[model samples]
Target: MSDDNGLPGAQTRRALLAGAGAVGAAVVLAACGGDEDPAGPGSAAPTAPDGSGEPGAADVVVRAADVPVGGGVILASKGVVVTQPTAGVFKGFSPICTHQRCPVSAVDGGTINCTCHNSRFSIEDGSVRSGPATQPLPAKEIVVDGDRISLA
Candidate 1:
């Protein structure tokens, strides 16, 4: 016997069950494996804008002593590198490497180096100083407000 839809009752029930199972499988697959949330644990919080009117720039600070002439250091807590390639000049860039999204492991001799894939970036302008990184690190707008630096 067929129901109003013209399919046998058992056939209709089977079809419904198959459809439900397919949906369930899809849901499971979606939740199985993927990249971790960018803001999850071990990830730094987004930087606050330094009010410089530049989009995506975040407010951040670096101790005048933390940066030295012709040198730089990565601020792991803020996901940025503060540099002073020359006396009285300061530059900031995202510490997260552009190549593989890995946090820069160190900065030496005005170069920001990512240990993950051996990518290196310049502290002067955040340009790609080496490979396998092809893109420059993003620079953040920074303002020296008194003894503190505000990022924008």
Candidate 2:
């Protein structure tokens, strides 16, 4: 009654479905990867390198003043967290937690926090600060023009 996978009744519909479910779960976990947070601390998100080709007003996400130094402001509607690690320097990152894709709830104590699993990412670079998360938040590109911060 065993099939190639060596499970009893493996030719039955129930057995096939159970095997498919296990394969699907394994694929999901493999995509999530391991404990290494490849984006090391202080690895800044990419920014516009020059003043050319700036995003217009409609792309603007916030005013530079709104994101405080050493902290961040999460724009839920835009799905980004804009952080000012130091004066006049801002970085943008996805607000979605790298662990489980939950929206990060707050930016405080120098990290972007996800209340779901208590994961935290560095406000400066989106690197994991404390985790159940092993990945840094994916970087989001932004342009800073005078006081306007816009998506890029």
Candidate 3:
């Protein structure tokens, strides 16, 4: 007994429902597709287009004096890490970890630590300091003009 589009046997109601479900699932997955950076401006950080938290070309990342001499600050909204490895030297790197592209959560003990899988990178050059991540965080160009740190 063939069904409407008839081939061999009649389609069961359950089978029809399952086929419909599969199509729905495919549509849902397609809607979610992308390799877009999850840390882009608003993951765990606040964002604004009115020149607030979001990093703009002219936005000051942080006051130079605000970052510690041997530590760094994670600017999640800016998607960058500003590190003062030495008193007068500053470095900037993408906040995203090389391990799984998770954002690094802290800068401590001369390392940028990603809480995702405990991967650490150098605060000095963004080099990998530990494993699970063989690559280093990519350098992010930043300008430190006197007392302000901004993306370059």
Task: Work out the TM-score per prediction.
Answer: 0.58, 0.63, 0.62
Stretch of 10 with least lDDT, candidate 2: 46-55
lDDT of 3 at 6: 67
- The per-prediction tally of clashing pairs is 5, 0, 0
In order, candidate lDDTs are: 0.79, 0.87, 0.86
The residue-by-residue lDDT of candidate 1 on 1-46, one tens digit each, is 4444674586778889999999999999988867777467887554
Per-residue alpha-carbon lDDT of model 3 for 23-115, expressed as tens digits? 999999988978775667556554543345645524787879989998999999988999999998999999999888898999999999999
Ranking by TM-score: 2, 3, 1
Q: Give a tens-digit lDDT track for model 2, residues 1-152.
A: 44547765656867789899999999999889976655876775434433334536556788898899999899989878999988999999999998999999999989999999999999888999899999999999999999889888
Q: Specify the highest-lDDT model's number.
A: 2
Instruction: For candidate 3, give the lDDT of residue 63.
Output: 78
Task: Evaluate model 2: give its lDDT.
Answer: 0.87
Supply the TM-score for candidate 1.
0.58
Q: In model 1, which runs have C-alpha deviations exceeding 4 angstroms?
A: 1-60
Which candidate tops TM-score? 2
